[model samples]
Target: MSAKYNHWHKSRHSDPNGDCVEVAKGSGGTIGVRDSKAGTPDIVLELSRTEWAHLLTRLRNV
Candidate 1:
Protein backbone atom coordinates (compact mmCIF):
# COMPACT_ATOMS: atom_id res chain seq x y z
CA MET A 1 0.00 0.00 0.00
CA SER A 2 1.02 3.61 -0.47
CA ALA A 3 2.74 5.45 2.37
CA LYS A 4 0.38 8.38 2.04
CA TYR A 5 -2.08 7.60 4.81
CA ASN A 6 -2.39 10.57 7.13
CA HIS A 7 -3.26 8.53 10.19
CA TRP A 8 -3.26 4.98 11.43
CA HIS A 9 -4.99 3.87 14.64
CA LYS A 10 -4.92 0.75 16.75
CA SER A 11 -8.06 -0.98 17.92
CA ARG A 12 -9.46 0.13 21.24
CA HIS A 13 -9.43 -3.48 22.37
CA SER A 14 -5.84 -4.08 21.36
CA ASP A 15 -3.67 -6.22 23.58
CA PRO A 16 -1.54 -4.35 26.04
CA ASN A 17 1.52 -6.20 24.82
CA GLY A 18 1.05 -4.72 21.34
CA ASP A 19 -0.09 -7.81 19.52
CA CYS A 20 -2.89 -6.36 17.45
CA VAL A 21 -3.85 -4.79 14.15
CA GLU A 22 -3.69 -1.19 13.04
CA VAL A 23 -6.07 0.38 10.58
CA ALA A 24 -5.91 3.44 8.39
CA LYS A 25 -8.02 5.22 5.81
CA GLY A 26 -6.30 5.58 2.50
CA SER A 27 -6.88 7.24 -0.82
CA GLY A 28 -9.98 6.47 -2.91
CA GLY A 29 -11.88 5.48 0.26
CA THR A 30 -9.91 2.31 0.79
CA ILE A 31 -9.13 0.91 4.21
CA GLY A 32 -5.73 -0.46 5.23
CA VAL A 33 -4.91 -3.01 7.90
CA ARG A 34 -1.54 -4.18 9.14
CA ASP A 35 -0.01 -6.12 11.99
CA SER A 36 0.85 -3.78 14.80
CA LYS A 37 3.77 -5.88 16.00
CA ALA A 38 5.31 -6.22 12.56
CA GLY A 39 7.12 -2.90 12.82
CA THR A 40 7.43 -0.50 9.89
CA PRO A 41 7.17 -1.41 6.20
CA ASP A 42 4.88 -4.33 6.90
CA ILE A 43 2.46 -5.83 4.42
CA VAL A 44 -0.84 -3.95 4.46
CA LEU A 45 -4.20 -5.50 3.66
CA GLU A 46 -6.35 -3.10 1.65
CA LEU A 47 -10.12 -3.36 1.45
CA SER A 48 -12.96 -1.39 -0.05
CA ARG A 49 -15.42 0.39 2.24
CA THR A 50 -18.05 -2.26 1.61
CA GLU A 51 -15.58 -5.05 2.28
CA TRP A 52 -14.55 -3.41 5.52
CA ALA A 53 -18.11 -3.08 6.69
CA HIS A 54 -18.82 -6.69 5.83
CA LEU A 55 -15.74 -7.83 7.68
CA LEU A 56 -16.71 -5.91 10.79
CA THR A 57 -20.18 -7.35 10.70
CA ARG A 58 -18.88 -10.88 10.39
CA LEU A 59 -16.41 -10.33 13.15
CA ARG A 60 -19.04 -8.93 15.46
CA ASN A 61 -21.25 -11.90 14.86
CA VAL A 62 -18.40 -14.23 15.67
Candidate 2:
Protein backbone atom coordinates (compact mmCIF):
# COMPACT_ATOMS: atom_id res chain seq x y z
CA MET A 1 0.00 0.00 0.00
CA SER A 2 1.10 3.60 -0.59
CA ALA A 3 2.78 4.89 2.52
CA LYS A 4 0.97 8.19 1.98
CA TYR A 5 -1.86 6.52 3.89
CA ASN A 6 0.36 7.01 6.95
CA HIS A 7 0.32 10.78 7.09
CA TRP A 8 3.10 12.76 8.73
CA HIS A 9 1.18 15.64 10.18
CA LYS A 10 2.75 18.90 11.29
CA SER A 11 2.96 19.88 14.92
CA ARG A 12 0.58 22.40 16.50
CA HIS A 13 3.39 24.02 18.39
CA SER A 14 2.48 27.71 18.09
CA ASP A 15 -0.38 27.80 15.63
CA PRO A 16 -3.64 27.60 17.57
CA ASN A 17 -6.04 27.88 14.64
CA GLY A 18 -4.60 24.91 12.71
CA ASP A 19 -2.72 27.11 10.24
CA CYS A 20 0.39 24.97 10.18
CA VAL A 21 2.59 23.04 7.80
CA GLU A 22 1.81 19.83 5.94
CA VAL A 23 3.57 16.49 6.25
CA ALA A 24 2.97 13.04 4.77
CA LYS A 25 4.75 9.74 4.36
CA GLY A 26 5.41 9.04 0.71
CA SER A 27 5.22 5.66 -0.93
CA GLY A 28 8.96 5.89 -1.56
CA GLY A 29 9.72 5.63 2.18
CA THR A 30 10.79 9.23 2.57
CA ILE A 31 8.87 11.78 4.59
CA GLY A 32 7.12 14.48 2.57
CA VAL A 33 6.32 17.89 4.04
CA ARG A 34 5.22 21.28 2.76
CA ASP A 35 3.96 24.67 3.76
CA SER A 36 0.19 24.67 4.11
CA LYS A 37 0.01 28.21 2.77
CA ALA A 38 2.19 27.51 -0.24
CA GLY A 39 0.49 27.60 -3.63
CA THR A 40 1.06 26.34 -7.19
CA PRO A 41 4.33 24.40 -7.05
CA ASP A 42 4.33 23.41 -3.41
CA ILE A 43 7.60 23.69 -1.56
CA VAL A 44 7.85 20.04 -0.68
CA LEU A 45 10.55 18.83 1.65
CA GLU A 46 11.59 15.21 1.48
CA LEU A 47 13.38 13.54 4.35
CA SER A 48 15.60 10.52 3.98
CA ARG A 49 14.61 7.20 5.54
CA THR A 50 17.32 7.46 8.16
CA GLU A 51 16.58 11.10 8.76
CA TRP A 52 12.93 10.40 9.24
CA ALA A 53 13.67 7.68 11.80
CA HIS A 54 15.94 9.97 13.79
CA LEU A 55 13.43 12.81 13.68
CA LEU A 56 10.67 10.62 15.05
CA THR A 57 12.93 9.40 17.81
CA ARG A 58 13.83 12.93 18.83
CA LEU A 59 10.24 14.16 18.70
CA ARG A 60 9.07 11.21 20.79
CA ASN A 61 11.15 12.43 23.69
CA VAL A 62 10.13 16.05 23.34
Q: In model 2, where do residues sit more than 4 Å from their true spots?
A: 1-8, 55-62
Q: Provide the TM-score for each candidate, comma-separated.
A: 0.83, 0.55
Worst 10 residues of 1 by lDDT: 1-10
RMSD of each: 1.7, 4.5
Global lDDT of each candidate: 0.83, 0.69
For model 1, the superposed segments whose C-alpha errors exceed 4 Å read none
Residue 2 of model 2, lDDT score? 27
lDDT of 1 by residue, 13-62 (tens): 89999788888988768898988677774678889899999999999999
Lowest summed lDDT over 10 consecutive residues: which window, candidate 2? 1-10
Q: Candidate 2 — number of clashing residue pairs? A: 0
Report model 2's TM-score to 2 decimal places: 0.55
